[model samples]
Target: MSRRPYKPVMSKTWYLKQPSYRNYMIREMSSVFIGLWTLNLLIGLGKLIQGPATWSQWLALQAHPLMILFSAVTLALALYHSLTWFRAVPQVMRIQIGTSFVPAKLITNAHIGAMVGFSAIVLLATLWGV
Candidate 1:
């Protein structure tokens, strides 16, 4: 008789068992949409490089309802990913000031603030065409 290693049975939805696990899975899954968004942008860049006609067609394609919906979903996932990453930063990065360490909330809040500030700058620049 040959002895075989036993494997424990686990459900495919094991991550759904805990809120943290679910969130982690969602955060990881968000990368797929983010990757799609990156690919979309790269395609647009290529179209732009091809010439004005191709760029115009790409821009028109983005105006479709389906593309708009995809953009919205991707934007939401990207924001969630960013927020989760910012929250985890405190745990992964330890910063000390003299004898004491900075509060985790402070670190997270600073990251959120910076994200907002940079986003605002980008929005303004885009609106101003500068």
Candidate 2:
């Protein structure tokens, strides 16, 4: 007699069952938006390379209400992805000094601080047309 191996079934939304699992799923999903945003940027670059008319059209397309909304959503997801990534850094990276390891909060806070500082610099430069 041949016996079939039993396979356990799980819910499609099993990730929603636990807070950690849900967060993990959300973080993973955010990558899709980030990737799409990056793809949009690449397309814009290609349009720019195609010359002034194409570039202007691409810029106009970005100015549309739907594109504006999409940018806002993408920005939010990117921020969430960055924060979660910073939080995970300390867990994955063990930075040791003598007999002690760096605190997770310190590592995460440093990353956040650097991000803010760089963002401010970029904003200033953009505003100043640098």
Candidate 3:
């Protein structure tokens, strides 16, 4: 019996062929931005603890053009990640009530609504603080 040769044939761009795969990759990439933003926040918090001058410096850095661009990108990525997660809920979580199945759209809408409500509260608190 002859041994067959193993084929090395995995394509790096396979995800580009399908829209869903592309969306998944984009959503996954959002985590990197999220991590960067979280680190930025932690550093800001540390600065705040140090003194008002240090905190002001941190805030000044955020006003830089590059920082602004980074913040915009991160915000976009965060929104995409959130929306993708909401879209995925129906597939991962199933709701049932005594032999009746809940609608997927309803679950997704509820998640989005809650997010908006929480965000509104945060915005209001921030305005109140200012």
- Per-candidate TM equals 0.94, 0.92, 0.89
Tell me the lDDT of candidate 3: 0.95
Clash count, one per candidate = 0, 0, 0
C-alpha displacement of 19 in model 2, angstroms? 1.2
User: Model 3 reaches what TM-score against the true structure?
Assistant: 0.89
Per-residue lDDT for 2-100 in model 3, tens only? 598788887999999999999999999999988999999999999999999999999999999999999999999999999999989989899999998
Which structure among the candidates has the greatest TM-score? 1
Give the best candidate by lDDT: 1
Ranking by TM-score: 1, 2, 3
lDDT of 2 by residue, 1-130 (tens): 4597777899999998999999999899999998998999999999999999999999999999999999999999889989999999999988999999999999999999999999999999999999
Worst 10 residues of 2 by lDDT: 1-10
Give me the displacement of residue 13 in model 3, in angstroms: 1.9
Model 3, residue pairs in steric clash: none
The residue-by-residue lDDT of candidate 1 on 1-130, one tens digit each, is 5598787999999999999999999999999999998999999999999999999999999999999999999999999999999999999999999999999999999999999999999999999999
